[model samples]
Every structure is written in structure tokens, then in C-alpha cells.
Target: MDAPLPPPLFPALAAPTDRPALRCGPDVLSYAELARAAGALAAGIAGSGRVAVWAAPTARTAVAVVAALLAGVPAVPLNPRSGERELAHILGDSAPELVLAGPADELPAALAALPRVDVELDGEGSGAVPPPAEADPESTALIVYTSGTTGPPKGVLLSRRAVAASLDALAEAWAWTADDVLVHGLPLFHVHGLVLGVLGPLRRGGEVRHLGGFSAEGVARELASGGTMLFGVPTMYHRLADALPGDPALVKALSGARLLVSGSAALPVRDHERIAAATGRTVVERYGMSETLMNTSVRPGGPPRPGTVGTPLPGVEVRLVEEDGSVLDGSDGETVGEVQVRGPNLFSGYLNRPDATEAAFDGGAAGGWFRTGDMAVREADGTIRLVGRKATDLIKSGGYKIGAGEIENALLDHPGVREAAVTGEPDPDLGERIVAWVVPSDPADPPADAALADHVARLLAPHKRPRVVRLLPSLPRNDLGKVLKKRLPRG
Candidate 1:
């Protein structure tokens, strides 16, 4: 006999309650209303194989995703800002049966070929909760496409067990409960914004308030009212840090927030200090990727470390391995190794890419460890500090391994530097020379190359100093505000 299936992912939706569940701008949905709306939508989309959701930051988008989960159909979240070429590739790769979008959203020409269903936030239903789909827990619940850095984007298959495990682990780490309200302005397409930000609240029987878009004023207004937590990317927090000095309301709101979390990219130590100086609250950082929902996070009541991404969540085992596949024994905080994770939070596999999926794991099929491709240093206390990606961030110069993230952080500490990114380039003598691309705080009066290089040498090591510094007006960035190092121009 086989093991029994787990209960519904969102048990709060099974019964009627007048408590608010979701809020996007002025639109609000109580638990009772959300259940009826999602049940009706689920009934219509039942047996629809796989569906796509236009993940706009709205209550309707949330309903569509919930309906798909309730009906046991997989949902592929499409980024509304994705280019036509990228969107076309994803649609062809996933081959969703239908697309679900808000009633007022105007999709681009690339989506015209697919069938669409307009989700109405205020639509009526039978006032009955839909039964959980009778399916194995290992079945796919979401197919999230990764950002295609090396090649075309591949669809990642995430199972219901993985999602549930990740959420439960996070709850234990953060001490999350039904009384906590999460406030964020993240796009609903990726795991940080969708799985943790939107679905997390629903699973915990809490409320989520999505700011149509992120703004310092909106964050202050919401947190000042009743919001308890804030989830944001580095860019969003950087803006908050910049605005906190001038906005008293923002400071008060942040000081009162139970938790302020940052992910998707590393939050600079400078930004963390600035916010703490103003609000007396420290921002917690977590590490994760598309293949792994969440591997590590700084516990809410644990020690406060600004540069590290805390310890692994409960049930997630994290290890650093050498190039020869030997696992590192102890955390010394100096040795850099590739991050490998094994846990229930791991994804099933990549959709239609068996070769890629197999390549992502190490030690054969039985190993069960997913190679994250991210490089990090484990501290003495078991905290993980991510240095950078192996492909782009690990710089081998002068017979030494150097991480670009630490150099970038040192550069940002200089008063003249506004933004910085580090990469390695081919050199005649050194195997790979360290190069620094900097955005000066003042374009009219940029810091000299010698001064900046000497600043880094004094703060870090002499060998880690940039061999060459290129000053730019601004650094190229993505929608989530991560610096696009690949797009940086080489001299």
C-alpha cells in the first residue's frame, strides 16, 4: 500500500471566515469570499491539463494560482514585463493549455496565440469550497521558468510536497503564524514573490497586502497600519534606506515591523546598517534559487549577522563540496566551495530537459543532492555567506581564489562609490585579473582609480584590490534590481 496524500496546501480556504485574506490596493477579499471565488474558478479550470497565469501583482492573479492548486492543475507564472522573444520561448517550452489574466490586463502579441481566461476579482460562486484534488503529493503543482542566462529558459517542475515543505520550514524559522500580515510589492512571477509572499500568507491563514508597485510611501502606510512583516529585494531595500533619512513615517513603520526580509540578491551591508541606524531594526537575509525553493535563512530570534544568509532551514541539509566532489568537513569561514542541498524542498526536475535535470544533481541518481552552482563560505557558527556564482563570480587571479562579492562590498563602503560590481578578465601575467566597474556618487567628481584601488587594498587584502577600475554613470540592472554583470561593457 502507498502512503496517503497530504492535506490541502491552504486549509484556511476550506471553510468560510470573515477575516481578510488578500488585499491589493483597494480591492480586498475575505477568507469566505476567496474560497467561493477560487472554488468557482477551479471548477471551470478542472481537467485543463496545465494552465498559465499572467502574474500581475493583483488579487485576481492570486486567485488564479489558488484555483489551479485547488484543482490539481499546474500553473506557469508568466512575467508581464518579459520581452516578446523570451515570452515566446517560454510559452512554446511549457505549452500551457490556457492563460489566466486579470480582466483589464492587455497582453502582448506573443500571448495572442494561446487561449485566455479573464479572472474577475469580484465574481460570484456557489459559496461552496472546492475539494482538494485527489493526487499524489509528488505531482507537479507549479512550473516556473528560470532566467535564461546561459541559454534559453527551461521550465522547472515543482511538486506539491516541495512547496509545502519549504513553507513549513520557513514558518518554523520565522515564527510565522496566522496573526501575521505580510506586506510586499514584489512581482508575483517568481518564488520569492509568489510562493513565499502570496501563497505563504494563505497557507498560514494570514493576510497579504500587495502594493500595486513598491514605493517607500506605500510601505510606510501599510506597515504603519497593521502590516507586521515586509519582504523585498535588495533594490527595494536600498530605496528604503535612501528614503529613511528623510521620511519619519518610513522609519517608524520599519521600527514596528516584526520582520524585514531580503532575498533574490544579496543586500549590501551598508544598506543594512543605514536602515538599522534609522529604525533600530535589522533586515534578515535568506538564500535560495529557482531549483531550490529555500535552503537557508536567518532565524528571527537568532544572532544578527548582516553579511551572512543564516543557517539552513529545518529539514534542509546544506553542504559545501570541493571540485572533486568531496564534502568540506567544518565551517572555517575562509574556504569557498560550491553549495549543494538535499531536502524535501528540492524540485522534482526540469520539464522536458532530462539531461539538464540529471546534470544538476551530483553523486548519481541516489545522491539526491542538487548542485546549486552558487559559491559560498560557511562560517564557524554554520551560517552561509554567499560569495557569488561559480560561472561569473569566482575570480582566479595570481594563484588565489577571490570572490567578487566581498570586493564589491568593500568598494561600496567608500563615500565616493554609489554602486559597484566586480568581474575577472583575461590577463597576460595573472591567470585572471580582478576588474572593478564602479558608479560614482557624483558624476561631476568621480573618484580616481588609484584612490579607489588603494581603498579596497586597505579594507581587504592587497592582492584582492582591483587591477583595473572602470567608472560608469550607472550599472546595468534587471527588473529585480540585480546588477547585470554580463551586460557590463569590457574595455
Candidate 2:
């Protein structure tokens, strides 16, 4: 009998008869019910390695994913609402022969149009127990794709060991209970939502209330119903803050959460302060990338320093190095270098493209360290504040290199600016110059170019400043809150 090592992800689901695992609107699935559904789907999938899941948000997608895992097939859950071209690309890239998908009442036709393999599992099954043959810890468990700023996209391959280790590490460090209800809606494509949103909560036996669409009203309703935790991006937080700025009832509903987490991209220090005051629940700012899962996080009620990603996580080792891949001098707190990490959770490699994979390890020679392209400067207290990505997000102006992220942080601090993107524009004098496309909080009251320039001068070094400022109602972005600065036309 082949025995799969007990998956670290299903301590809660391990005993399906013990509790209710998922609640999607009026539908509530117990551990037992979900286990049964997953088993049927798993049996149907058998072993195709990867299966495309085009289902809308339901107990169904969750069921299919778990089932696929049980049957030794890796589940590739695509965003069902994408265009035909996008879906076709996914199908072509993944090369999945099977797809289990359906559109429920809450899910519309748009979500159902993506390629899905239909399977008939009437929800009458119960191989909830992991396969007797434990899955290989080193086997490819997940393949998450990130839309590259410069190119099409790259598939980040994560192994089962990495996924299991990451989840186990999180559960051991963060205290959670079966009775806690976590409100989550971030898409399943990205690791932030998939690993943390689904894998982490389920690992701890916590009840998850996964929503398809996010709105203050909808979130408030769920929180009011006793959701103990909420995870969202900075944009989502801003919208929630806007919808109910300083309402006590709204705050209470938000505060009812045991934890409020903000991640995916850098959270503006200004927005963090405002939302913290409004809700009275300190938001735990976390740092993560598609390549490496979460690396650092700011604890609630700590000093809550501005612009710093505080401390390395458990079982995680971090080091700072120069552009030439040399370690930074400990004496210089201002020494900015690339962030490097070696951990159990580090990615194996890009799905294909050996050259790119080799290039990713530029800084990691000694240990199994994965080179994170983002540049960072270390503080005396050991918090690593990210400057920007050296790969595509850096801007050069007047013979000096500038991190667009640094300028964007300064722009978000302004009362009138809601969002901003900084990019390089062709300049004959300097190699390239800084240009910022800004989204004003109030479109009717746009800031003048001079006023914006003055604002930039206050925080950034002269060379780091954006010489060209354009006023726009909103900056273009991807499915995630990442600013698509490259897409904004330069004047």
C-alpha cells in the first residue's frame, strides 16, 4: 500500500466529520461533505498531473482542488471570467487534458466560458483521508503564473514540500482555531490568496467565508455575521475606508475581526495610519512576491514603523547584497542592496526557460537562496525596506537610478492623490527622466503639475523626483493591485 505523507494543509479537513469547513452564502459545507465531494472529483481526475478548473466560486472549485490533490493530480484553477484569448493561452501553456467547471447561481456566464472539463461527481464519496501512498514532498504541487511587466508572463513552479512547509510554518507561528471565520475573496490564481486564503485557513480548521465580489456593504455584512479575520490588498482597504471612513459601526464590524491583514503590494504609510485609526484594528502589513511566498510581516500593536517590512519570518533566512552580488557592509544602514532569501518555501524554478531560471539565482550561490530582484536597504533594527524591483520597476533619471516604488510611496502620502505610478520617459539630457501618472482622490479637484512637483520635492531626493507629472482619474492596474506603470502613455 502506497501511503501519501499526511498533507500539512488539511489538519482541519483531516477529520471531515468534526466541523463545518466552508460557508458560501446560503450553502454551508461540512468537513465531511466537502471531503466526500473532493473524493469523487479526485477519482474522476485519476492522474492527469494537472487539471484546469474553470468553475465559479462555490464549494465546487474548492472541492475539485482538494479532490485533484487527493487523486494525485495538481489542480490548476483558472479565473473563469477571463477572455477567450487569455483562457486559450492558459490552456495552451498548462496543457491540461481535464477540466472540471460549472457556473452556479452566484457565478455568471462570463465565469463559465473559460475552458473547463466537466465531470460528474454527485457528491457521494468519502476518500477524505490522504492517499495511503503519501505524495512526494518534492513533487510539483502548484504552478502559479505572474503577468510580467516586460513580457507575457512566467509560471512560478512551487513544489508540494514548499507548499506544505509554508503552510505548516504559518500554522505553527500564527494561532488559529476551528471556530474562527475568515473572510476572503482574493482570486485563487495568485499564491497570496491561494496559499494564505485557502490553504492556511483550511490547515487550521478555520471556517472560511469566500466571496466572489468584494464591496464594503458585502464585507460588512459578512463581518457582522461573525467573521474573525479579513485579508485584502491596499486598494481594497482604500475602498473600504472610503465607503465608511470613520463610522463607528463600520469600525466595529471591521474590528470584530481577530486579524486584519494587508499585502500583495506595499501599503502606503498614510493609508495604513488612516485605516488603523478608523477601524481601531492594527492592520498586519505583510510582504510577499509571486516567486517567494510571504517573507516578512509587521505584527499588530508593534511600533508600526512607516515603509519598513519588519523582520524575517520563522524558518526563513534573509541577506542583503550589492548589485555585484556582494554582501552589504553591516556598518552602513543606508546601504541599499538586493534582497535574497533561502528557505524551505522557496520556489523550485520557473516552469520552463532554463536561462531565466539560471538568471534568477544570480545572487544565490552558497545556500539554496533565491535571488529576489527587488532592491532593499536594511535598518539598524533589521527591518528590510524595499526600494524597488531592479528587473523592471526601476527608473533612471539624470544619471541616477531611482526606484519607482519610492516615488509612489511619497505620492500616496499626499491628501489629494489616491494612486500613482512612476516610470521613466526618454530624456536627452539625462539618460531617462521620471514621469508620474497620478490618480487624484477627487477628480474634480486635480492638482496642478507645479503643486505635484512641489509635493514630490518635499520627500524624495532631487534626482529621485518625478519631473513630469500627469493627472489622471486612475492609474491602470492588473487583476492584482500592482500598478501597470509601463502601460501608462508618457507625454
Candidate 3:
């Protein structure tokens, strides 16, 4: 029609310009309109700019994100209601040349000087025009920042090639079809929401239902609202299960789902079974991180194993390697050493942090290999079982190793505990023992420490059972919804 622009610069996504692209509230924008809105916004901003969209999960924010991608600018999504300190820090880090906000909300005085773009195409002032560059596989496409171990936030750079390859692998491996309708209710900032939930579906012209804020009730309602798939974190699944009556509807929708997926954090094997019991479907727990969108997933249509994050997807090349970069000989399961993966889906580098990049590549080179900090033992059946995270999440007691996740999973299966996070605290003899912080689903019936200890005693060996268990309001979780064990209060 009008010069046929580069097929919208992505293959997995079909520019469904004729079909309704974003269905939000009472408004629906056709794919053509959505593209135009994004293209206009893209054209309005300078290349080396930052665009902070509404932090809340929404179809509108989804549009802004895609438009930013096509326009060749980086969009830093932030919570619209972020605290002053958080907003301040992110603004400083991203250093956007402009800001994007909807009508009616006044621009923050801090960003008053920055040109504001109205989603309705009101701000027409041209800053520097962004040069047209083909979406390079290795070039940085997005910079997602996380509160670093200790310093300013660190941004994980994902290039177009990386995301594209990820989509191809997921679509093929999970057998996602363009016709699938996924009800995704996770926060969009993390890799799971962005890579798997949003981009994965959109790239293939699948339908997505968005919740501005996640509510288990809202998610369940939406799932009943013509959804064919459910993709969310284990926490989300838990909330959904709790909100529902008996997990029947949860299971019904989940069982009826073309696929039910969980990632970003471990899906406790027990929760997987609990969700399946309630919903009548297996919640396929997958594995990946910010560095790699999705390398392995528990089978969707097949077994949906309780503890294993299934084999590597078709395009992904996985190997077990020693710390010194030597490949291991352990495919008895599927070669479980430190998981070193090379594929188009893996990220190029961490943004502007050469030292971090160098350290990341210590186990391998820079093609597509990511030395995942996860210590997993691949089984002979091609399934991988995660032992724990190297950076954190592993607890040592009495010279043996126990994954905090394993202990937490056992606690959650007790039916009394709602949430659990295990960490290593000082112990005289065992060096370090497992300390679990638990949140009770039923406050009145919260199990006592002795009761929980006994329950865990049945599930784990005497040594692996939690040495100490404490009830809490919630576990410390980071922005990405990962438990911050270091932040857990010492008992």
C-alpha cells in the first residue's frame, strides 16, 4: 500500500493491521492503527533516547513497547506509581531524552523539561530523527535493568536477533500457533512476561489478554473469558489457585488451555502438581533467565514432569561444562554440569559493563553460549533437574548440599504454608543449616514451627529438613519477583 515498510521488521509477528491488535477496556486498535501509533511515537523520539511507558501491565503499554522496538529506540518501562526513590534512580540510569505519558496525567516536575509524547500523537516536535537500521541480531534491542548485587541497577541487553531466535525456538518447541489465545497476567518487566508471555505470542499473531494489575480473581475471570493458554509465574499460579474455589476452574481453564507455562522463577514441583490437581492440567514449568529468555521447558503436551525443566528447545544447544570451560561427559541424563548454552536466543552482553560481560563469558565464548549459574544434574532422559543457584539460593548443611528451592517446595506441599524461602544461617556444627521463612495461606490455621518441622521431616531427610522455620508476612522479593534471601530477616 504505502511503500510496504520492511514487513514491520519482524518475522514471528505478522502485522495484523486488519485485525484488532490491542483490546483494552472498551478500546480496540487495529494492527495498522497500533503500528501507526507506535511508528509515530518512534519517529517523534531521538534514537539515543529513553521512553518510560506505564509501569503497569496493559495492552496500551504493550503497544508502546512494540512501537519503541520498530522505531529503534529503547523503552524503559516503569511503574506509573513508583516511589520517588525508585523513579528517580531509574530515570537517572536510563537518561531518556523524552518521556511518554497518557492524557490527563501531568508530567512529573523532574521530567517537566523533557518533551512529552501523547499516545494520541499530540507531541510532534522532532528531536533528532533515529537512523533506520536493520534489526541486527547482535545489536542491543532492549536494556532491562535490575537492582544489581550492590550498586546502580544493571541492564541486561537483549538484541533483536536474540529475541527473534527465542521466539522461533519457543514457537516451534512449545508448538505455539498463531491462533492460540493466551491469558497472560504477569508483570511485563521481567523476561518471562516480556519474552515468553508478550513477545512470544505477538510475534506469531496470537491473542493476549492483559491485566493492568495482576489479581488472581481477574486472571481466573479472564481465563474463563475465551483464553486458550495460561502463562505466568508459580507465584501467580499459587494466587490463582488460592483465589479459586477448588482449583476446578483453574484446572478447567488450565486443562482446556492449549498450554500452561510457568517460568522466571522455579515452579515448585509440588505446586505444579497442586495446580494440576486443582485445574486438571499440568502447569508446564520452564527454565531461563534474563540472559536467556527460555532455553528449556517442561513438556507442555507430554509428561509435564514435576521437578524437571525439560530438554533444550530445538534451536538451543546445551552442554554441561566445568568452570574452566571444558565440556563435561554427562548426558546420562542430558549432560548436567554448569549449563552452558549457545544459540541465537542468548544475549550479546550486559549493557556498558565490560567486566560483567567478561566474567559472564569465562565459562565459554560469545556466540550464543550463556554459562547459567544454575547447578543442575541433567538426567539420562534429557530432563534437567536444578540443584540450586550458584550466586545464591543454595544452602549447605553438614557438608551436604540442599537447594533452598527443594526445601521450599516441600514446605509448600504441606497445605498449611502459602510461601517459603530458605536461606543459610549460621550453625555451630553443620556450618550452615536451612532457615525457612514461611507465609501461611490460612492465617488462623498456620502450622507451628514444630508441626512444619515434622511435615518437612516426612518430605526431606533429617538433615535436609529446615533447621528453623519462622512465619512471616511475605518473603523479600526483588523487582523481578525473585526472592531476595539475603534480605530475609535473621531469626
Best by TM-score: 1
Tens-place lDDT digits, model 2, residues 42-130: 66677676777654656566667777766667666676556666666666677777667653423334334444555433465446655
Give the higher-TM-score candidate: 1 or 3: 1
* Candidate 2: stretches off by over 4 Å: 1-8, 103-122, 125-128, 177-179, 331-333, 363-367
Error of 1 at 284 (Å): 0.2
lDDT of 3: 0.69
How well does candidate 2 match the true structure in TM-score terms? 0.90
The positional error of residue 484 in candidate 3, measured at the CA in angstroms, is 2.1
lDDT value, residue 94 of candidate 2? 72
Lowest summed lDDT across 10 adjacent residues in model 2 is found at: 103-112
Q: How close is candidate 1 to the true structure, as a TM-score?
A: 0.98
Which digits, one per residue and each the tens of the lDDT, describe model 1 over residues 325-420?
999988998888999999999999899998999899996434579999898999999899998988899999998888899899889889899899
* Best prediction by lDDT: 1
Instruction: Please report, in order, the local distance difference test score of every candidate based on alpha carbons.
Output: 0.91, 0.72, 0.69
Query: Model 3: what TM-score?
Result: 0.87
Q: Write the per-residue lDDT of candidate 3 for residues 296-353, one digit (tens) a residue.
A: 8776678668877898987888777664667777666423357777777777776677
| Segments of candidate 3 deviating more than 4 angstroms | 1-15, 46-50, 81-83, 105-110, 121-133, 246-251, 320-328, 331-337, 363-365, 441-451
Off by over 4 Å in 1: 1-5, 132-134, 365-367
Best-to-worst ranking by lDDT: 1, 2, 3
The clash numbers for all candidates, in the given order, read 0, 12, 14
